[model samples]
Target chain A: MVKAIDIPFGPQHPALEEPINFTFEVEEERVVDVKIRLGYIHRGIEKLAENRTYHQNVYLVERICGICSFAHTTCYTQAVEELLGVDIPERAKYIRTIFCEMERIQNHYLWLGFTAKAMGFETLFMYTWRDREAMLEVLEMISGKRVNYGMNTIGGVRRDITGKMVERMEERLNYLEERANYYKKVCTKERSILKRTVGVGMLEPSDALNLCAVGPTLRASGIPQDVRADEPYAAYGEIPFRVVTYDGCDVASRILVRIDEIIESVKMIRRALDGMPQGPIRVKVPKNVPKGEAVSLVEAPRGEDLHYLRSDGSDRPARLKVRAPTLANLPSLRKMLKGVNIADIPIVIAGIDPCLACMERVILVDTKSKKGQAWSGEELWRYANEWYRES
Target chain B: MAALNLNRIRRRLKGRVQEVFVQRERRIFIRVAEEDLRETVKTLIRLDGFNHLATITGVDIGPAIELIYHIIYKDAVVSLKVQVPKESPVLPTITDLIPGAVFYEREIQDLLGVKFEGNSSSSLFILPDGWPDGVHPLRKEWTLGRISKKVRRLW
Candidate 1:
């Protein structure tokens, strides 16, 4: 019998984009157990939001997650708007929906690239990222920023999507749709991707529901639970789109769900653009929100993003809570990591599209010797690649 | 549709809930005593079909800390609000019923100094290891100045 070893995989590792640590207990090749430690990148944003005024908190909340900035801002603004008892104009709602879908497309592409790179498919990574640039360019053109598009405000969006911008966005959307189809073909036909991802990191449907896995992860496990379809916030009530789901309950199904959702996002954006109503984008809201509390849910690219706000009849919020999708998906991630080979760690971690920062180092501790070895995330990536090649 | 769910939940949890506030179409907030949180959650999950626990939010409300377990039922957010006095900010763990709540509970424990009675893992979840004990940042007393002053000594 081989002795078990503890591999501390990140608060800073190459495979992890964020500073979250996962301690894996390994016996030979299989992982016996897992423990997760988070808050390495805790910015105290919720506490900060309490100090900032309701208007200023929009920008503060947007900084919570770089990729889902709009989702954060939207949720924040929606909660505050509810507190103020304001309904945004129909045009503003359409604009919010368009940006939400645009963000989803770019985010899924980013995840696809990173997951491909994690699986040692460098070419696919480069290609997906290249196609992702078109979506980013359109976002930059509309919001004047790539990642954190501060488009949302208390009553409505900050900027309006003009006719010229709409035309350019349409052109970009067509290109993205074509690229998405091609990538779908590649993801389905490629033998290496199939071998690497298929039947890997399974989270059963019951386990997923009990664990409260959200976004693509839950949908991939055969659950059709989606906030957009369920709650219909923003303009999702007016827009028609499918909540994509797959029953494979593995890494490959997650890949398929994301890819299919990107196509759905593309369709949603096109429809929003075509059917967008004309009206004032921004409305006047009171200086201070009343003494009320509200909860807002947005279907962020990764999963369900929830924000809660309470006012004390003051300029600032009494309290604010932001639950990013990554936090919701962490438990399911723990469930997925169990019983998998050590070599499959990177792919499984990348499969969730965790919204975090870069890693610097990793520590591997042998339980028997009580000795430790420090390694970089790149080292682990290389080790996984070599192990797969040898096997 | 949302009102129907609200009425069903109101009728089911009639005696348990202190106040049921329908903030909007799909948002329902129910205030319950600390002891009834587990049973209330059980009812929501088992009978009401509010299986998805979106998150748990804790706010330091002057004399008491407000703990809101935001559970998703269909399209609505049924937030179960329970307040525990600041002196003894302890509550039962819902992790047994919904295992995903362990992280959120630990987060509240770390930041607000709330204790989950039956939670197994007591070590810090979100805060850094060296973060000073009893310095719950989310509490109203731990203002920006106080936090910086307390956290600054560590460096």
Candidate 2:
């Protein structure tokens, strides 16, 4: 007889970088149902945005998520600029595009390393992290900061990419391209990676659409939806790039999608550098914005990051709403979690490339005992690694 | 392409909606009533291809709470806006139509006090577990100071 057991994984788990709770109902080895509770780290950023001026909110929104800081600031500034009825300079647009793609590269590299660690491939994790540092060095060189670039402003970018910076960035991109190709080969051919990721956490293409999955998660499931391709914000309209997609509809497919996206981002950055026009980096605007509202979308590393702004002819916004890509992808995560093994849970969660800070919260509950237990995410990670080793 | 989509949306939602206005290129706003919300969404999905519900933003006006359902069709964002009175603060849930709306609806319910009827889950989504009742932080009247004071009193 199969005994039904409720296993609570994380409000603090080793597998997750941030806190989130998932209570898994397991019938033997297979998961029967899963319940997610959030709000462990909700800081109320949306309510706070309405209280700050448009200029200050640029820095404020960047704090939403460290990995996708530029994505948030870019979306926020674009909405405010639209309300102000100002078109940023051409050079600034290209500069913004370069930074956006650079951010994608760094973010994908970080995720690649983190997922490798989750799967117990320590050597691969180390290799990816070493390669990722080069990308971060280039970012720090351009923006004077490693994590939150703070490159975006209301009118345009805060800084310019000089000829020297472009040359340095090109050298880094060439190096990153080689490392990306190496990872692509390993991800496709490595026996352990293939065994762990292939056919695991399967999400049907139809389910992915109906559940509203976005970014690489949607593309990996054979849909070619991307904000940059569809909406053509910033310099994307002028630059040429392909929307990467795969038919695997599994964890392996998600990995391939992000790796291919890194290659595409590198190429796009080079193209943006080549086609960059020489002009001012910013255009001045008045303090008070006009009475208007606008919605801006940015194709963040994870998915489509959206921002809605309503201005009431004041320096401060009437309302500000941010829909991080992770929030849109959570429903799909719930769909993916059903019917997977206990060992596969961590990788499946990591497969979404979730930025819980951008979204928020997690708690675990034991239904059998009718009580909640605190299990660190790291312990769950160790358990999965050990289970895979024993198997 | 966006213009064509806008015209089709305007024509399709002409009589059913209160008003339709284009904020700019690719940004379409339709002021809809609470009763017509489901029908309008169904028409957008089944007739036109606005299958993706980008997000729902709820704002607290003085007399009523305004809900904006930002739906994406191709390149354009066709927003369906609905207003419910503050006293009642209730509207039909669209979770049956789009399953992904469950989280967004719960978020609005927790922060703005606009109850989405039939949403199923009543758990606090983004707020702390022991948050005081009837205190919607997103409403304009609940300033930072008032919220802090209320929570301090509770503690």
Candidate 3:
């Protein structure tokens, strides 16, 4: 009988941040079964939201995952606004859409560079990261912060995009569009890169749906499902852009999907800027949200972010549930990892662009008692450090 | 189109459901007894083509645990909620209908004390190792300070 051995992958690694360990059961360098352990960064944000006021929870939710901070706050605030029955102004919707698309561009660029770096395409990684600075500069210009731009609140955005800001954004987007086109060519035609990515991590379209994958990971498999196109939050209802699906269903196709999406985001941002309605940016929302529950879904840069809010006629929420995209995409990652070479694990994972910090929760199962065990984050970190040192 | 399909499902499960209403535009909420939960979701899947399982959110109400299964049908999201008594928080698993529910089920079972009858990986998934037995942090009774103190004592 061929024996399968276990390879402990990570609570810490170079390909991504956030502590997630994958226990891969391998037979002759091929991964057969996978086990996952999480919770290295669990801050109990959902529990914390219950004690804080609605206004304070906005900033709290934004910190759930820095890469998708705006998406989290937008989703949370939209749910709160719905609970309060507050209607934000039209101009605020346009500005919100612009920021969302800009964040998408910045996020997609970061993923492209990271994936390329994983594949050892260092030059392309540097190029993508360098060009990515343009989008980050635009975000900072508008919101005055790079990562966690505290622009979103209950009724609308805290910042506005002026005509000069729009002009500067247009110039940068034009440049990004040009570079995106070039990256598209490089992704598709470059021989070495193609060899590493094409057909490396294959997830069938049906499997993607069955696994309930979200965002670009689902779109790359040719599902044509997007919350922005389907639900039409913010200015997406007025803006026109493609859903950007690729049927290749491989790591290479994921690259193509993200690059194409960058172009689409640029176009949508331009549309939102040019056709922006002139009006107030926010409306006055009541301090205490009415007793009600609201569900808000937004297409985050990574995937669809869902927020479920329940308020019991008080300033603080009764329960706040944030389902980040990576959480929805984790099962799909396990499915994609099956039957692949151990060497391909990094590229396969990088393709998902997992934000483990956003979805952190620890699981400790006592094998003898078959019961759950609680361990602190500090203890988990120490355990990981010891494991690393011993290995 | 979505509303009509939802209405048809609502009509089908008229007596089985506890309460059913459209929460807002493009969102629906269905509350069902614990026994009717899986069958209700299967009926919705068959009727409205609800193939996507958005998420399963578990909340601790005083005497029971509330499980909300957000299923996506076309453009609208339909939430199916089932409440199990806190003393024996056990419910049938719908992972057979939607394979993706397995992760969320495991998570709920971990954070809350709920048990799914047929879920395969209904083990600890999101909690840290050495967590105390019979202590659920997500429950209403478990205060933030209490959980921190418990963790500190363990450390």
**Candidate 3 lDDT score relative to the true structure:** 0.87
lDDT of 3 by residue, A1-391 (tens): 5799999999887267668889999999899988887777778889999987788788789889888899998899999999998889999999889889989999999999999988989999999999999999998998987878889988999988898988899899999999999999988889999999888888998899888998999988999989999899998999888999999999999999999999999889888888998989998787788988888999999999999999899989999998898889988999999999999999999999888765435568888999998889899768855753453
Task: Please give the fraction of native interface contacts (Cα pairs under 8 Å between A and B) kept by each candidate.
Answer: 0.79, 0.72, 0.68
What is the TM-score, restricted to chain A, for candidate 2? 0.91
> What DockQ class does candidate 3 belong to?
medium
For model 2, the docking class works out as medium
lDDT of 3 by residue, B22-140 (tens): 87777888899899887788777776555599999999888989999988877678888999999989998888888887788888887888989898463568888888887788898
lDDT of 1 at A191: 99
* Cα distance off (Å), candidate 2, residue B152: 2.9
Tell me how each candidate scores on DockQ against the true complex.
0.73, 0.70, 0.67
Name the lDDT value of residue B24 in candidate 1: 77
Candidate 2 chain A, poorest ten consecutive residues by summed lDDT: A356-365
lDDT digits (tens) for residues B13-86 of candidate 1: 87898999988787889999998988888888865445589999999989999999999887578888999999
Query: Interface-residue RMSD per candidate?
Result: 1.0, 1.0, 1.0
- Show pairs that collide, candidate 1: A12-A359, A12-A360, A13-A359, A14-A377, A17-A357, A18-A356, A18-A357
Ranking by DockQ: 1, 2, 3
Indicate the DockQ of the complex predicted as candidate 1. Answer: 0.73
lDDT digits (tens) for residues A9-49 of candidate 1: 88786375567888999999999899989888888988988
> What lDDT score is found at residue B63 in candidate 1?
99
lDDT over C-alpha atoms for residue A369 of model 3: 93
